[model samples]
Target: MQRNGPIALAFHSLVVVFMLAPMVVVCLVAFTPENTLAMPWNGLSLRWFKAVFHHADFMSSFGNSVRLALLSATISTVFAVPAALAITRYDFRGREALNALFLSPLIIPHLVLGVAFLRLFSLMGMGGSFGWLVATHAIVVTPYTLRLILASLTSMDRNAENAARTLGAAEWTVFRRITMPLMLPGVSGGWLLAFINSFDELTMSIFVTSPSTVTLPVRMYMYASESIDPMMAAVSTLMIALATITMIILDRLFGLDRLLVGKG
Candidate 1:
């Protein structure tokens, strides 16, 4: 393997710092003793963090985001598995078209999707409904799950499946015992990625979400527009902490290198 030289290493370190600087600044600002969104240079205080918990709107928005992420991620995973199996295991007319349809969201901008969904929901008289919001998010995140499941299915060895069938195992049994297990890593990784995306989603959500179903990002955006305070910084800090904790849990349970990069 080629090792990075000192210059290359320095450049990469700078890139990492650049990417992380904003988040680091936000977190630090969250600890500020000042009322404004400034760094905690004089001293640190938990006032903003406490305020976030006590704030009804933020808490309600947080709950909505969690439910949305969970439902959308699970729904997408359930659909992606069957769709991936059909695409990878069968050869049929329009097979390529079906695959492209499943992946088209990756190419289409979210802004367009939000507008399309908004119009569709209005026509169906389902505007601002939590159920419809979840459905739209599921559609948006399905491509991520589908791609991961497809990669898992394609890279999987079929010998075990063949052997099981030859041994008189039912097709369903073979799939349940062999195929599902083999693709579990992909399924899990895809679900996590989908959940994260759905949780952090903003543009599409802003259009689809109603007053009652407002998500955290949407709420944060509204708050930022109305005020400039350490409370927004506090909210951002909490989100960053949530993401960090999730990554730590995933790394501990599955090893990030294995789950993310397919390297054990």
Candidate 2:
């Protein structure tokens, strides 16, 4: 097997450091004892972390973001699974158009979608409604779910399905027993990706969110605009920790290599 050359190894190491530097800095600043955002040179403190918990706006925004991400990711998955099945398993009129429509969000800019959704919601008298917000997020994240589900479906072996059908198994029974299990890894990975994206969404969320429905990213943006403090860094560190924990759990449950790269 060919191994990475010294130059290639050095380049990869630099890339990793470049990507991780900001997160490392934020985590370090989060421990600062000073009121201002800075590295904890003199001493480490947990006051900012405690402040994040005590701050009502941040807590509320965190709750909203969690609920929003959960709902949107699940909703997108529910739709994406069936849509993926139909797209892959059958021939239908306008199949290409249907596939394109579902994936349109990937190409259209979020800023444009946000504005369009805002106008549509206003006309429908649904502006600032949490349900509508969840729907919008589901729409934005659907393409992620769809693509993964499509990959799962396309890569699936058909022999088991054919054998089950040959033995007089019903289509639903075959799907439940064989197909769904095969696609589970992709479904789960897609859901996690969608959830993360929804949780971190900012650009479109800013336009659509009302004060009552503000998300964590939106709240953080507002707070940072008004003040510069270690508390912001603390909040960011916590968010990074959350994302890390989530990925760890996903890796444990599904094997990230298998779920992401179709490796056994």
Candidate 3:
């Protein structure tokens, strides 16, 4: 066991570095003084970061992505909380099937779902509608929120709920005061996951969104197709920074191990 421990630790370190290297590179390149992208020292400067803010298209798309992510994550959580609660707290016909249905989107390929949405929206004459984009993102991200909430629900102690009900506490009151507080960590984790997914979504957004509603990822894709520059790196770095901050906050508040694996 002791011999294996060092090997396992080394393997884990390598895996983490492998996963994070690209992001670190992007952040490094974002500080390049030149407009072009290159590694090694360029006498680090914030020119690209400044350019990203001044770039009208990038700014607009960034706003759109933030709006869509917030809306989609909030709506997905709202729908998922009830579904998760139902699946865990009640026994009903088709419960297993219903769970599968909510999770089906995760199994489906994003490209295939994008194509399907394009066809469906075309038939409905709602192609390129912002509402359709929001709805599709919500559907795509709901499974994540549902899974987290379900994990919390399953791990939570039921004795408190039972005692509250036994003492004549109403169902709504029990849920509001007891259940919701206990579920907050899962809810927040799910929301953050959903938000990240929605914000980073490109394939589905490309099919459903109009030029006016283009998301940051899609916009970045289009820009990259036209040119390669440190501006893209700057945008990516900003996103990475935002995600890192969010994770840090969550880790401090509820502990990610508890939220993800139900253990602290």
Candidate 4:
């Protein structure tokens, strides 16, 4: 493997700092004692963090966001597994089309999808329902799960599966015992990716969310529209922390570098 030259290393460091600077600022602002999102803090404080829980809308929305992300990610993974299997294991009509359909959301603008979903659900009289939001989120996140699992499947050796079958192991037994265990890392990584995307989602969520189904990101947008405060920073900081922790857990369990580099 070739090592990065000094120029490449410097460029990478600068890019990383550029990307992280906003998050660092937000984390710092979250500790500001002042009410506004201004610099030169009057001393570090946790008041805004405390205020985050006190705000009724934010609290409720945070819970809703958590539930939505979990459900969407799990469901997406369940659906993705089978689709990925079909794509990688069998030759069938529309296989390419099916893969394309699964990945369509990535190419299409999210705002357009949001409008389409809104209009479709309205016609079905299911507009603004929690289930409606979950379904949409699953659709958007499925491709991530499918791609991850497909990568895992494509890289998997067929010898184990063949050996199991030759030993009279049923198809389900081979899958449940052999394939699934090997695919676990991909499945887990996919779930984390979907969860992060769903949790941070705002564009499509903005269209489908009802007053009753408002998520944390949408709520944050609404609040920021009316107010400028460290509370928003606190909320952002918390979200950043949650995502960071998730990534750390993923790295510990699955070797994040291996997973991202398609070695899973």
Candidate 5:
């Protein structure tokens, strides 16, 4: 057992290295000095980042992405919380099926879903608009919010609400004051997940975006398709940084660990 331990350790280390190697290469190449992609040995510079800023369209796309992410995340969470509460707090016919449908998006392919939405929007006379994009994004991110809120609601005890009701508290009061505070962690976590989902969405956005409604991911896709540039990597790196900052802010505001499987 001891003799094989070193081999196992080395193998796992190799696996990790393999996974990280591409990211390391991307970071290095983003700083390449040459017009075309090259290695650091030739020289390294922040010229690509400057190009990304000077492009101006990149900033527009970034702003659009932020707006879309925030709007979709908030709207999705709003719908998902009520949906989760209804499923968990109230018994009803077809509850199981409803829950399944809410979660089905996670299993469905985004590309296929995007195509379906494009058709649906066309039929409804709402294709290729910000409204359509927001609705589609909300649907895509709904599963994340639903799952988190459902888990949180199930883990939370209803004894407090029952006690409050027995003491003459109204249903709305119990829900808002007691249940909501307890479920805040899951709700916040759901919002974070939804934000990330909408912010980084690609395939769906590609099908639905109009010229004016284009998001950063769609813009990046267009740029990468038309011209393979290091600016793609720079934009991606900025997105990662922003996502990290958002996560930190959310975790600080709401207990990140509590929403999963544990009590705070």
Candidate 6:
């Protein structure tokens, strides 16, 4: 008889508990009647959630975040996928260095980029523009898309494309007809990750945002600066729900494990 794995299961359970605790706490606090967020036992009420729904500023910021995230994710995917194809399909000088350069966004501090963009926008006489925000978000989101798209390209069998070309299919036809479908999973996963990164981004968004063009994270920052209430908890809980739903949808699109941790 085979024995069950005990330590492995226990460790996995602990990790899940740890990851869930903060979200659970925030969800509970969202219903608290008290002004302060405490864990000791207090009566629960739906008042805070009601206020969160009614806030015009919150709705506006949420809409802006969605718009920017969609725009940035699409832009990043289009640019990065083509760049990834070129880098992976053809041998070029400085290949490794160029890949590193594309990934530099991950290393650079977002706050620094924020300030740089602000100064650049001002110098260009385009300060406080929505296009600037979208452009900055695309830059930030590009690396993830490139990484996944490259991996997809690597997983592909070169023989098929060679055969397609041998059979009279053009280079563009080979890519469009054979390669694109195989790479869809990675492209999709990258797009979702890019959108989430843009949605959750705060530091970079601060420098780009104006009163008329603020994202949700910026609104949350401003709100936190002024108040410490259950309303924030309600908003946080809603965000957590959205994140969970997004992950579930992504898992359905491309197996979540394979998307994040490469398949053996």
Candidate 2 achieves a global lDDT of 0.91
- Give the worst 10-residue stretch by lDDT in candidate 4: 255-264
lDDT, residue 26, candidate 6? 91
Q: Model 4: how large is the Cα RMSD against the reference? A: 2.1
TM-scores for every candidate against the unseen true structure: 0.92, 0.93, 0.94, 0.94, 0.88, 0.89
| Predicted structure 6, TM vs. truth | 0.89
lDDT of each: 0.89, 0.91, 0.90, 0.90, 0.85, 0.87
Clashes by residue pair, model 5: none
lDDT of 3 at 222: 97
- Assess candidate 1 and give its TM-score to the true structure: 0.92
Model 1 lDDT tens row, 1-264? 247587798899999999999999999999999988788999999999999999999999999999999999999999999999999899999999998998898899999999999999989898999999999999999988887778778888999999999999999999999999998877887787788889999999999999999999999999989988999999998888887876676555445665556433
Q: Write the per-residue lDDT of candidate 5 for residues 1-264, one digit (tens) a residue.
A: 999999999999999999978777778888888777666677778888888888888889888888898999999899989999989878999999998988898999999998999888899898778877888899899988877788788888889999999999998999899999998878888899899989999988988888888899889989988987778777776777777787786677555675444334
Candidate 4, backbone clash total: 0
Q: Per-residue lDDT for 95-208 in model 4, tens only?
A: 999999999988988899999999999899999899989999999998877877887888888899999999999999999999999988888988888898899999999999
> RMSD, each candidate, Å?
2.4, 2.2, 1.7, 2.1, 2.6, 2.9
Candidate 3 lDDT tens digits, 1-264: 999999999999999999989999999999888757886384878888889999999999999999999999999999999999999999999999999999999999999999999999999999988888999999999998888889888889989999999999999999999999998888898898889889989987888889899999999999999999888999999988888887787676566787667443
Judged by whole-model lDDT over C-alpha atoms, candidate 1 comes out at 0.89
What is the RMSD, in Å, between candidate 6 and the native fold over all Cα?
Answer: 2.9
Ranking by lDDT: 2, 4, 3, 1, 6, 5
Off by over 4 Å in 1: 1-4, 248-264
